[model samples]
Target chain A: MEDRFEVSILLDFYGTLLTDKQIDIMNMYFNEDLSLGEIAEINETSRQAIHDSIKRCYKQLKNHEDKLKLKEKYLNKKTEKENLMKELSKVESIDNDLLEYIDKKLELIINI
Target chain B: MEDRFEVSILLDFYGTLLTDKQIDIMNMYFNEDLSLGEIAEINETSRQAIHDSIKRCYKQLKNHEDKLKLKEKYLNKKTEKENLMKELSKVESIDNDLLEYIDKKLELIINI
Candidate 1:
């Protein structure tokens, strides 16, 4: 479950690097959790073809992740932020203003 | 000056997406601050060819930046961290541990 979510996150980051068709297929397969047969039927193609496309798109996305490691960086940043927030929780009552600022900044990071 | 630095930052993020030759040429030209003639001499190619390669690599890097925006994400993260640090400075005496943790995390992000 988490692995598929990771793939979807990669698709969000690097989807534009792929072709429009590839992006659509990935969204259907990964995000929509559609079977290859369903995607093939919708695109009027063979299931084999959809399978091949998904495989290729997955390879491409993985290559991007390997080369750039943007996903890894993102995960690291998220962890760091979480740790910082946790540490801040230890000092909550004493520094309410700083606590509020960090909270808002975390939200900003999520949206960005 | 900042523009070239920005390009170098983009290269750091997307340089691996390029071919080995393209990455080498970009590093020489952008990071080493080499002229086309200098890179041409090192690569044993004509200056015009080197220029063309640099232009193409630049376009490729820009396209990657446009698509993934890892640089923009990094900058935004930096700004957010800086702002948080600034806010923390106001409450330095109150929460030393959180301030120290954030300082370490910012350095970690930069290295990552």
Candidate 2:
């Protein structure tokens, strides 16, 4: 049950939960497109520190994902919700019963 | 310019470029939170195939990011656009000059 989550969940969670500096570096390097040297310069840290912070953040993110599986669950629910939305969107006309069914499905998606 | 792009750009592009089967496996395992075993059973492929596909996808994504730098540029531009929008939204009153400035900024954002 727990072993089924994606590797990126760890990465995302780690990115979210780490120190602001670490998150900044990760976002800059991974999300923002900054080089290690540039990040080091901006943050006034060494390139090695930036590199080590990234590696550590990666490990932590992976470990958390492996243990918690929250990101995986969230992603699965998101994908399911998206698919349901696509299906609903494709229906040009909806009977009352179908609309009610879709409303219930949407409720489930929103709650998740 | 090239070295500054985030790592995930590569991943996203690779995910887009791969075979449907490979993409499906990736979305299920990484994006959809399916287990390797579960994905294997659904796809009727071996666990090793799933593992290898993920690894290969990761490599390709990284290579593309390193080579093209498209993702990084896109992200930086996106972040800047978001910030500009945020700034524009915070203004309670807009004079003609300010409105014109914002319109130009919006046009740039839209074109990007």
Candidate 3:
């Protein structure tokens, strides 16, 4: 399940970078939770065709993830930033200067 | 971008649910860095058809993500598990009984 999320990240990236039909199919299955039969009906294609496309897409997305490793790095940075934000939020009191500094840092992190 | 990773996760999930053609286009674009013209040439389709399919796919994927929120929860749990693992790994030494317990817990997390 955890790995699935990682895979999801890869897929989303792939969708954006790839062709429209790929994105459409991805959205239909993942977003709509449609069965292969249902998707085929909608797309006017066969279930086997849909299944093959999905499997191939998964492989390609995973391959990209393995090569780039961008998703892992991004997740790590996001986790760190979230933790820092939590810490900052828990602080009961802060000097005005420190508060300003933290706010600035947070803004930058959030923007990223 | 940070948001892009989250989107990627959604796309990957969508791809799994979609048709074979969808997956093929996704792999061609995201994994192979193929342009729309190239993709159309390979698929023996019109560029406009590819464009429409991709745009529609993005919209549908985002819609699913917005409604389901599964990706967000998964990411949070994963981040927490990773932190716990890090803490456990940092311990200098452990008593036999405690080590057994920690190891058990770590094993469960890794399996998840």
| Top-lDDT structure, candidate number | 1
The root-mean-square deviation over C-alpha atoms between each candidate and the true structure, in angstroms, is 3.1, 20.0, 16.4
The residue-by-residue lDDT of candidate 3 on B33-87, one tens digit each, is: 6888899998899998887776666676666556444466456545655554455
What TM-score quantifies how close candidate 2 is to the native fold? 0.37
Q: Model 3 over residues A44-97: C-alpha lDDT tens digits?
A: 999999888877777777765664444664566556555544554544543455
Q: Candidate 3 i-RMS (Å)?
A: 13.0
lDDT, candidate 1, B1-112, per-residue tens = 2267977898888878899999898888888898989999999989999989888888888888888777887788778777867877786465676567778876685556
Question: What is the number of backbone collisions in each predicted candidate, taken in the order shown?
Answer: 0, 4, 15
Q: Give the TM-score, chain B only, in order for the candidates.
A: 0.86, 0.64, 0.67
TM-score of each: 0.83, 0.37, 0.41
**DockQ of candidate 2, scored on C-alphas against the true complex (2 decimals):** 0.02
Clash list (residue pairs), candidate 2: A33-B4, A33-B5, A33-B6, B10-B61
Clashing pairs in 1: none
Task: Please identify model 1 stretches exceeding 4 Å from their true place.
Answer: A1-3, A92-104, B1-3, B91-101
lDDT of 2 by residue, A45-91 (tens): 89999888877877776665564444654566456555544554555
lDDT of 2 by residue, B1-112 (tens): 1121333345454444566776676677665677888988997889888778777766766665564444554565456545544554555543455445544543343232
Among all windows of 10 consecutive residues in model 2 chain A, the one with the lowest summed lDDT is A1-10
